[model samples]
Target: MIASGCDCEIFEAGPGRVVRRARDGRSLEREAAVMRHARRHGFPAPEVLDADGPDILMERLEGPSLMEEVASTPGQAAEHGRLLASLLRRLSGVPAPGWLQAAPGGPGNRLLHLDLHPANVLMTPDGPRVIDWANAGRGAPGADVACTWLVLATAPAGPSLEGWRDGVLAAFLEGVDAAAARRHLPAVADRRRADEHISAVEKAEISAFVARETALT
Candidate 1:
């Protein structure tokens, strides 16, 4: 077994296969379906080999995560940002599958990766491949982008890593409309607040940010 998270445990099944067993069987099934859909649409995602009950067997992608690279290779911050932005653009352009539904108060038509962050992206030989589809669904592109921005902005980092984060955010927003993303911040923050994974301190920070941004708008 390689990694274990709150929801799932990942194991290397063999040279080409990886097994993901989720505590919640339904969520694992949903994740497998989402990956299959993404792959069908030419998105960079794992190929699902089998999905039985709570276990999902998928193609093993080898490489460091984008988060690892960003923390270790500060000089490549801009490049990573560009790559992430491109991936977001591509994901946003893909039409959501019929079974997907938007989160409450979010746009219902656009495909959204609600939890897309550096840690969820793997730097593969082919390129960066997005993983962890647990929070993906149909929603506003701005909401998705805003969620990413929030994650980047609020992530705990040391003094040394702060500059890298800033560079990445700067590059990410180079061609993006800051206003549009900012507009969704409050909504995204609200959604994030309800997540069990968020700590009380983090929730308080997000809530305060939302209140401040709401007043300005």
Candidate 2:
């Protein structure tokens, strides 16, 4: 077990994991490219120091996890959501290298960060540094947003659920025109319809249910 100074609990076993093996050169290369792209495009992510092999040395961040940091605060949650929305827009605006491909586990035709939870973000002195880029790629920003909302809805709920919703929508759409948001809401919402159609989220009550779970815990 290679325990670095930071929160790195890596293993050097040859089990196909990055920190477990001496290789996965292709995966390392892809990770480097993604990190570089995020950096160049101004997305808050870790800096890559070495990307030659399985053990891609990189800068580790310090500070609170976005989840714990804002777990008790709705205002903070809203602001964070807004920032994420802006970040997604910026990342999508840029052209990713050819190597970045859509690899959704479920049936989908768009790129997405299928698992974007707050735990994956590492807050640093600069700001929130996006920790995990393994699930990022060219996909529907709407679905990404939905997945984001899903996690947000599931995480530690704030004092006021409706207020948090207001803040998230307000911040997430800070620069977006009201008309545009209204117009695109349906399309953005349609992406989540797959889950309902497939019975993953069979009813509107699911959102409230998740909120209750987070709050009660």
Candidate 3:
């Protein structure tokens, strides 16, 4: 078994399946349900093999995370960005389940992966499969995209990573409506600020970005 994060541990149950158990049983069950919903809607995600209380058994996907691949192969930034954009677009078309709450918006009922980022994507032999559905919910597509933008912008970085970040951002924006994403920056920032996991530095940065974006609105 391997520790995945503060709340969960993962174990390779067999050649074809892995099990994830979270500290919060309810959250784990919700995550499993969201993953199943995503897979049913044709999203490239792990199939749920079984679910019992806080433990979820899922198809074991073998591959390095997209974040690792992008860091090692900077030249493939554009391709990876395009793939990510396509996945987001597909996700936008999926209807959120009734249980999920909308992200302070009206008119759209899209399922949102509130924490979509390269680290959550794995490049399997079949394709790029998204994981970590614990934060999945309902929201406007623009808001969801804005959350992704903030994640990319605030990721720990050094001078050398700037070029790779810009390359990926440029490619991703080419496939998305930049104006729409900008419109939701404030709301996204507000939501992120409320997350207990965010550090003071990140909250300040997000606040500044939100202020700038709000001024333009």
- Badly placed stretches (over 4 Å) of model 2 are 1-27, 72-75, 103-114, 155-217
lDDT of 3 by residue, 20-59 (tens): 9986655477788888988899988789988888899998
lDDT per residue for candidate 1 within 1-217, as digits (tens), equals 9989987889999888899998666547787888898888889989999998889999998999999899899999988788777888888877888789776445657767888889999998988899988888887677878888788777667665767888898888774555677888987888888889888988887877677766776
Candidate 2 lDDT score relative to the true structure: 0.54
Candidate 3 TM-score, C-alpha based: 0.91
Q: Which stretches of candidate 1 lie over 4 Å from their true place?
A: 25-27, 158-160, 212-216
For model 3, the superposed segments whose C-alpha errors exceed 4 Å read 25-27, 105-107, 158-162
User: What lDDT is reached at residue 97 by model 2?
Assistant: 57
Lowest lDDT block of 10, candidate 2: 16-25
Q: Which stretch of 10 consecutive residues in model 3 shows the poorest summed lDDT? A: 100-109
Candidate 3 backbone clash number:
0
RMSD of 1: 1.8
The best-first sequence of candidates by lDDT reads 1, 3, 2
Task: Please give each candidate's TM-score.
Answer: 0.92, 0.58, 0.91
